[model samples]
Target: MGHLRQIFLFLVSIFIISTSYSQIEISGQVFDDQDEKLIGATVMVSKDSVSSILAYGISDANGKFKIAVNNESDVLFLKVSYIGFGTFKKTIQNKAQTLEVKLSPSSESLKEVIVKSEILRQRGDTLSFSIAAFKGKNDRVIADVLKKIPGIHIRPNGQILYKNEPIQKYYIEGLDLLEGRYNLANNNLSVEAVSKVEILENHQLVRVLDSLEFSDRASINIRLKKDITLSATATAGIGAAPLLWQTKVTPMIFTKKQQAIVTYQSNNTGTDVSGEISNFTIKYAGVNFDIDKKDWLSIQKVLVPPFSPERWLDNNVHLGSVNILQRI
Candidate 1:
């Protein structure tokens, strides 16, 4: 009891504050049987080794105390030990607030139930996820993050189909990054740098001068991480056949009013360079925006106005040009 008294010193209301999935803070105070707020109560939570400053807190003069966490604290622990009284343990299983803990003098050395112990200082989670959130189990490339988007699809022949057709454009961080032969960007762009995936369906590249003309199509816009937009990426990888040793070097420079992306891809199979330069400044609201039923049927008219038959000798030079841009 002598050493125990030294451990619990004056700590009574022990509170730990932290955040998890969203912005959540965990707080609690401790008091004694006499309703006296315990001061100097010890609280400790072991955080990931990336950094120290784990969960911790103490009590105040009013016989009250508190603890807090700034990050996810699902695995926290709270231990309270004082002299002349037996130590107690509590398990904070989930994120909760307004906790009231009352400690009594030592009657027996009863051990705390591991499951019921509140030693886990805090509880919260901001990012809740599951495997189903991803597009395909075969999403092996960064572009796969885009393909999994609800309205997007990848045609078997290498064409990027959004809402089941050729995509008009592709962008990253609101910057047009690929022009044609997008396989390079799809294969080289790291998904880790993407913060949001936008699927533009029945996309109209131009806002509008007059409703007299219209084109219905789709596109993919990747919102890259802030750090990625202003930098370039050069990747070299060696994989199996169908994809042997290859080098993809893409150097991009972007500014407010202008952007230039130079992509060079080479393999035993093929070699291509895609350069996109435009004075157009891009500003977007969101991807996968829902169009009303009336807008959908109306745009469908512009998209497929009287499909003329394609002869065996019919040349798709325009479609081919669009396909070239899609290959990146």
Candidate 2:
């Protein structure tokens, strides 16, 4: 009986030693196609036939990662993923104790994935529109393209509305080139030059109070194509019967450190050109301004036309504006 008990203890000890020796450690470095170290790459290990994750880690700043597995007999599946790179996958048997992974650039694959996805993508507080998916042959300018976008509308008077409300600000490449007037850029800028349009929802213009203050206002931003550096547009029309004429010339320049837009418009056709250079009231801001203050007491004594003021007034309007923005 004593010998039998001793033999049982010896078998138990050997089983424990074998189990400890079966565990394995995996270590590896991740690199890009150019042999550059890829930091923050995700590394995942799972059973070859199972979908459950066994171990996972992210590559350090040096692109190095390590993970340990208690059951080496189980076939492991490794997956690594990073932005702008194709996913790397491999099946690990007993021989793969260490790994060196090289991820290839996947521009075409990434674009395909994006195309297969939805036309609109909301990340954080920004909503992005894919230009190719929303553009049409009838779209001559940015305004025309915006009219087709979901939750966005362009009025006949050149006002832009998002989610049935007007936006507070309009920007180009992170710069407010139009200040309070965005009609010139939206109506005259070429749609071919634009690559994407982003709406910053719940935006706080002030950076310091962004976290502390909450705002319901949104802003529109235009992103130009990479190859387009400068663009100009000009339109002129004349009518014979009513003797009406209109002309508009807009030139724009965009760069890394600066942006500029110069506009000139003249018309006798009753189109309000001042809307291109002035700021309009945003209803979300709860701001009100009484620009037309007419005293009824004095006007009552004079003979006024019963028609609307706009119909009774007749004048030629001319406007010229230059907006330059510099970024340090």
Q: Which stretches of candidate 1 lie over 4 Å from their true place?
A: 1-141, 175-177, 210-215, 227-246, 253-258, 267-328
The global Cα lDDT (0 to 1) of model 2 is 0.75
Candidate 2 residue-wise lDDT at 284: 37
RMSD (Å) of each candidate, 1 decimal: 20.8, 19.3
Q: Which lDDT tens digits does candidate 2 get at residues 62-106?
A: 999887766555578887877677778898874337799999877
Candidate 1 on 1-328: residue-level lDDT in tens? 9888866654432321222333334566667898788764544333432233244454445545454554465654445544445555565543545566667777653443321232222112111111123435566546566554433566533456654566667665455544434554566455555455555544566667225545576566665556424444665767764555556566554444454555555544232222211211223373333211212233333343343322122221111111111222
TM-score for each predicted model, relative to the true structure: 0.35, 0.56
Question: TM-score of predicted model 1?
Answer: 0.35
- Model 2, residue 45: distance off in Å is 37
> Judged by TM-score, which candidate is best?
2
> Which regions of candidate 2 fall more than 4 Å away from where they truly are?
1-118, 239-244, 281-314
lDDT of each: 0.47, 0.75
Query: What are the clashing pairs of model 2?
Result: none
